[model samples]
Target: MKQRSSPSAMTDFYSAAALVTGGGTGIGRATSLALVREGVRSITISYATSAAEAERTAKELDSLGATVLVVRADVRSTGDITAMFDLAANKFGRLDILINNAGTTRYVDLKDLDGLTDEIWDLTLDTNLRGLFKCCRAAALMLKKSGGAIVNVASIAGLRGVGSSIAYSVSKAGVIQLTRVLAVALAPEVRVNCVVPGMVLTNWIERGGGGISTEEEAFRVAAATPLERVALAEDVADVILGLVRSKLVTGEEIVIDGGKGLTY
Candidate 1:
């Protein structure tokens, strides 16, 4: 009798090397750790301004017996992106996973069109959308060689059209579409997918200038959420890991909002 092999048996990470952008903190940090736990032995994590945190995460990965490379690369800068990918290629000789998790947003009130200034809009679009595209382009050739996977971290705001600001929502929406396009563009060699998380309880809010300001406000959001809670960074990381390991799935967006979008 012939038996089917397990998906885990088919997609082994023990020999895989991965790169995670924004891998210093929040969801990026969580995803990097998850990959190490899944037996990925070599990983490169890139950070724009989270050098201290990136160092901390590198130490953690080292402690887990994974060879870790930490690079300071701002995705907005083409030179930085190119240098980061070049370093990863030099160190690992191959890359099997790419996680596009670096992004930025500002907390402008939805109706405050004037508050969504050009600077804020430009920064959000450049970092979240344009920068993500550049990372994909730089990794495309290596990913093709390794038959790798890409998991982009987007937001449910893109689908629901509500988030920190108009620019942020729009940028994430771009991420979703970009994932779909890249899935086809990289087909038969690489798979690309996206995870759309909602109301994740991370420092992102504080760092984004505090849209969900208070603990009480956060609790209210959890109460309003259909699942009676908000997502943790680890929750989103799990989804991203799943997408990375899915051998046959691509061009898909998995929403991880604890069913929050159902109400909307």
Candidate 2:
């Protein structure tokens, strides 16, 4: 017997019901918008800053008549992440995709590890590494029950020893490891993969590496990439979509690095 479809489910028959963390701006924002364009009717964007930016994304997506929710969240907190899952699943009925995109970066001077203190390490790991694990743990359970996809936002630093800073690089490397483990553990029910970006012009750069440097210097380093340019958020978005929908692929890191790795 053919399964009967309801009016509500029918609206999203070809659409994904998804959750995107750190969706207020930059790569997360671009990915959320792209997901909408790809026919996801129900989307919840979680962020930690700039409620206005989140609202702007919601408003823009609303024009498509898609259901959009912008929630303030700290991925580092289990309570917040858990609540988001509950709310998203409750609203959408089921979650088909989870994009783990929330993270922070810093320039680490190993020689000053003493000065760095435990607070700095905890803060960085809490958000980038530990938070990602918690989210996947929560999302994996939800996705396992229904069979879905997870796209973890990592960095090229995970693949190579190079990145904006040692901490950022190491955190992202942990993300890739987490993705691999989850991919195997999730099995046939839920697929897990990663996307790694290189030299993207986002707020993190301005705040961490490029914050004190001149814009031209930033451009010079970015242009040193093989593609002679840095990645755009949208560039990362397209690759994410491909990974999310591809059932045959899991436990891989798609690099949106403008072929920067090839330059060597």
Candidate 3:
């Protein structure tokens, strides 16, 4: 794969700052790196429990000559989320970008109603949906001050009904809707958009055992895709980079599944 050194379009991010939630790994990590490569001067990345991963990401970004702040935060806690925004604002002096990428889910059969316990539902909705809303709300002031942009990492599961779990699917669906609502509300000041990724080859899936339990299943899914492949974290991040750089684009949801979603 040809790596993108920076966003295709030029952006003033070289002098700006950003905050990326769940930036420890997966698409979040890729987005964080993309932002740094695109010349974002300072970034605050939040990780729930991935301290090792967060440290690794920080080191990588630091090596690239970007100011990085790694915070331990749980999206479910309003206080932690608020602190994340405050730290970014205080350290960076201004916040120009917010990436709502923190999310959680467990792999469960859709037919197993008993397996979809209240705890699982709460965990998924609180982190994936409600927590994202809180982050966006907390970021409003800083973003408005700099006329910044917000890019949410939703999933193709949100558009369809297939995902790791029913609650996860519902939560992501809420994220898609939330993106549109925030876009209209923050208009003329801050832009809000989302990227819906489909079946990305990330450790997140393996951790949750998201039905692709074997390499064979993954290969089958890839073969079924029109593009003969699934999405990569960097692929989704590139689309996000475009959204962040485009001053004229807002309230849009970009699908980055390499045409796999079309089959669904």
Candidate 4:
């Protein structure tokens, strides 16, 4: 990849190493590529079940001249999260950035409280909220040593209180609040921020997993949006890259919804 001019003098990507969870696909993949384009040479990407996709992404990063390490890690398990961080530390000796993008959700209407079973709530909370927290904790010492930055992936669902399921929305809301608290806790050593994306045209929605599963439904959402379009994963990734490079910004959430949230 062609390297771009460094955005901030405070952070040097050429000498830094980063860890991106869920780096196999979607926003995570985009963010990993953005880091490579910014001259970051070393990266460790963690995935849950997308082993094949993670390998593909690693190959692409290698082609871009980045030193890539792909690891299988399910964020829902503390042991997995710990092992992933340990391996990164051993391989890179330091960590300069962390992107907490691994998450899971189920499709159930918000009003159907009964459908939002205990299993759904547990899975969503454990994977999205709890898992993210564990990853942050695991990377804390290294990030503090490097004065690194963390950009978390939240959702417009947290802000608007509407999403695939009540549990999913609630879990994301926790992530937003957790970002703010961690910013204070990490202090001058590390910066924490979040990105809230609206309807992005990714496989998550295209495959009928997230709501608006079909192209026709997605088009309707885009037409209703103020910008008359949905977001691409790269769009959100750009904001994530900006946040990581920024020195003064912390505990902030940038929304990449094409202005759809304003109407609601």
Candidate 5:
């Protein structure tokens, strides 16, 4: 193979400032680590309330010689999201990437209107759909000036009907639509995309979410997927990192569902 030019060699080094929401655990945590390995200088990890885990992650990244800021910002709040990104811009001097990964979920039986409750439905939509809106609005402002990349952590639930809960499925479906809309709206200035993952082996799932259970049956149901197994956080994170650099990839949904969305 012939030697590559200096420009190609500097691609990884060029990743200076990046921000990832929900970075306290799972896919967010994996992506945060991956960014550091790719030479991202400073990163802001945003979480709703997981302060201890966030601080621990910050310390770990700092120990690796990377500047990691653990910021407490609920994606559901427009004010909080906007302020957090503003703080990130000031801290790093330049914003290069944004990963909209923070989300909320619950399980519900749509048939039982009384049991589902209006509050539950609203909360689900608020965080998964409205929260994404708030973060994208703020991130858009930063990326327009600097020309950055955004990867929304959507889920297979968004693409199909299976998920932790009924409200979760609906909220995620909205997220998929939001991703496409923003990808077009942001256009040439900022590259926006989304990732849809299937049964990822995360703490949230193993511990049982609202509508989903951590039973042998659930695992069997997921394992029966096309890939015959589930995915790890790192597996999905690798895909997110690749999508972040593509100048041509926008208004696209990259499915990382272990072929679960595909034929058996």
Candidate 6:
């Protein structure tokens, strides 16, 4: 059942459960909190290295009278992805939503062909594209059981060839196409959709040293956006939450870039 209304207005997720990848920070963190606030029955947040942040988020969700499970896993590894889903299924019994939000990138200049080496390409493709495919495959059966939904966090870069690096942009393009394919692959039982966020304010850019000139690049993008503002993680999260609950939505890639994509 999809809540076609405001996220805060919907409170019918009493028996629903969710698994959020990269749930320690940014859009993932915001989505996890939104799920809990919407009265989801259980939530399992998977983090790659942000153990402390995950623990802290878990504590906050737990304090809100929500069941929270934090798992350490990397999407790049199939074994870790399997284990993460296993833990969620074991703890929550069934999953109603899967948020594939974990991703990785580097800050190599687009013109530096040498910088886009095999290692860099593999790192970006493995984590952002292949890893996400594996996660969706692993969760397919479980989600089928509950007629669950999937919301993948992609980027506006997937739509345009502008992002951190050439490899990163290419991988996200794959993510967009992957979402479309999986939606058809898992139809009638589960829904698959993606969110393409533009220039959101998050530490991911700083951590990855994305090809941006400064952390304030988001504000610059915002200034050019028709909305006259950059996106926040919560803004992306809100759209994701809606996608997760939408009964009629599948294979849809909604851009949450606040019209930034139009200019670029």
Number of the top-ranking candidate, with lDDT as the measure: 1
Task: Tell me how many residue pairs clash in candidate 5.
Answer: 1
Cα shift from native, residue 133, model 1 (Å): 0.4
TM-score of each: 0.93, 0.89, 0.93, 0.94, 0.89, 0.92
Put the candidates in lDDT order, highest first. 1, 4, 3, 6, 2, 5
- The regions of model 2 sitting more than 4 angstroms off are 1-13, 209-218
Number of colliding residue pairs in each model: 0, 0, 0, 0, 1, 1
lDDT by residue (tens digit), candidate 4, 1-264: 995332322358999999999998999999999999999999999999999999999999999999998999999999999999999999988899999999988888789988999999999999999999999999998898888899999999998868889898999899999999999998778899999999887777755454445687678998889889888889999999999988889999999988888897
Tens-digit lDDT string for candidate 1 (65-144) = 99999999999999999999999999999998999999998888899999999999989999999999999999998888
Alpha-carbon deviation at 134 in model 2, angstroms: 1.0
What C-alpha lDDT does candidate 4 achieve relative to the native structure?
Answer: 0.90
lDDT of 6 by residue, 1-264 (tens): 974432222225878888999997888889898888888859999989889999988988898788988999989999998998998889888888899999888888789889889999998999999999999999998888888889998998888868889999998889889999999998777889999998888886666554555447866777788999888899998999889778788999999878876765
Q: Give, for candidate 1, the lowest lDDT window spanning 10 residues.
A: 3-12
Cα lDDT tens digits, model 2, 40-147, are 888999988678999999998888777987888898899998898888888888887889999886666555556665666788789999998898888876677667
* lDDT (Cα, 0-100) at 23 in candidate 2: 85
In lDDT terms, how accurate is model 1? 0.91
The residue-by-residue lDDT of candidate 5 on 1-264, one tens digit each, is 994222311145345688999997889999998888877878999998888888888887787778877889977777888789889988887777888889877655546546766888888888888988888787776676667788998888887867767788888888888888898898767778899987777777755545455455447756667767778899999999988878677878888877776764
For model 1, state the Cα shift of residue 7 in Å: 16
Q: Which residue pairs come into collision in candidate 1?
A: none
* CA lDDT scores, all candidates in order: 0.91, 0.81, 0.87, 0.90, 0.80, 0.86
Clashes of 3: 0
